[model samples]
Target: MASMKFACIVIMCFAVVGAPIAQAISCGQVGNNLKPCLRYIMSFWGSVPGLCCDGVKTVMAHVQNTADKRATCNCLKSMVAKIGFVPWRAKSIPRECGVVLPYEISTSINCDKLEL
Candidate 1:
């Protein structure tokens, strides 16, 4: 009985961990999805238009341990960047990703500013 229960637990764990990570559509209704993040960066960097999409993408890409987590985080972060005419609050984006958002930041998700 114990062995059977253990097998069931393992199966459940696999099913939970094996779920596919959903992808996000880039600012479907907005222009140049990077604009918002860039805009936010601009305000901080003396209104300079160059904000660094590559840096943002890299930070977002490493936000997770798995491919799914990376993809999902990337999408959510991108959305926030685009929407943030000003900087965004860290608490907002995590809700979209269904994550608790540890205080530690990853490579691409440098949205520490509460500018929004």
Candidate 2:
């Protein structure tokens, strides 16, 4: 009975501890991380800010799976559409920041089809 109780406690601990890891990346997180890059993304010609690169790297680091990538992509697309940024400037952000993204950053990108 003691062993069974311990096992139950272990299981409950895993359920509680692992829940956040299994949860999908939220748009709020995506927005917060990418917010610093807006100025660079909007400008026609200028150096990418260090803060912007840091933000990009931070967001990319959080993408643990395809679902997270898709969620981030969708969030980015929605943000771009609403804010109206230069497409090429936005697409170049990852490269300028020394981060290689699997998908291009564009509003037309189909987030549902994103893969790891």
Candidate 3:
């Protein structure tokens, strides 16, 4: 019984500590990765720059799970809204990078509607 209780405590501790780190990994670092894509996302360019595509690919690669993906998507949407990035242009970034995201990238996207 004592061993079982100790194991449960350890599990709980890991759960508590892991969630924030996981969210940070998905949401927090997105802006820095996306910085390279700013100009491409903001205005008409002949084509997305190599650095922008690389950043898009890197951002997509970080989403390891449904929750993380949703969080990352929401973070991207919010950031786009704040930065005045064109929705269609922002939507094209992942595709331009050959990264297929599960949902459309739009400021109006509802994160809860995303499929896991």
Instruction: Give the distance in Å from residue 80's predicted Cα in candidate 1 to where it truly belongs.
Output: 1.2
Query: What lDDT score is found at residue 57 in candidate 3?
Result: 78
How would you encode candidate 1's per-residue C-alpha lDDT over 23-91 as one tens digit per residue? 533334222433444444334443322333433343444444444344444455566544443443333
For residues 1-116, could you state the per-residue lDDT of candidate 3 as single tens digits? 99999999999998888856433355657888778888877887667788878877778777787777788889988888788676678788777888888888787779877766
Report residue 35 deviation for candidate 1 (angstroms): 19
By lDDT, highest first, what's the ranking? 2, 3, 1
Clashing pairs in 1: 37-81, 59-107, 59-108, 60-108, 87-116
Residue pairs clashing in model 3 are: none
- Candidate with more favorable, higher lDDT: 2 or 3: 2
Displacement of residue 49 (Cα, Å) in model 1 is 33
Top of the candidates by TM-score: 2
Using Cα atoms with residue i matched to residue i, what is each candidate's TM-score against the true structure? 0.27, 0.79, 0.73
Regarding lDDT, does 1 or 3 come out ahead?
Answer: 3
Off by over 4 Å in 3: 1-26
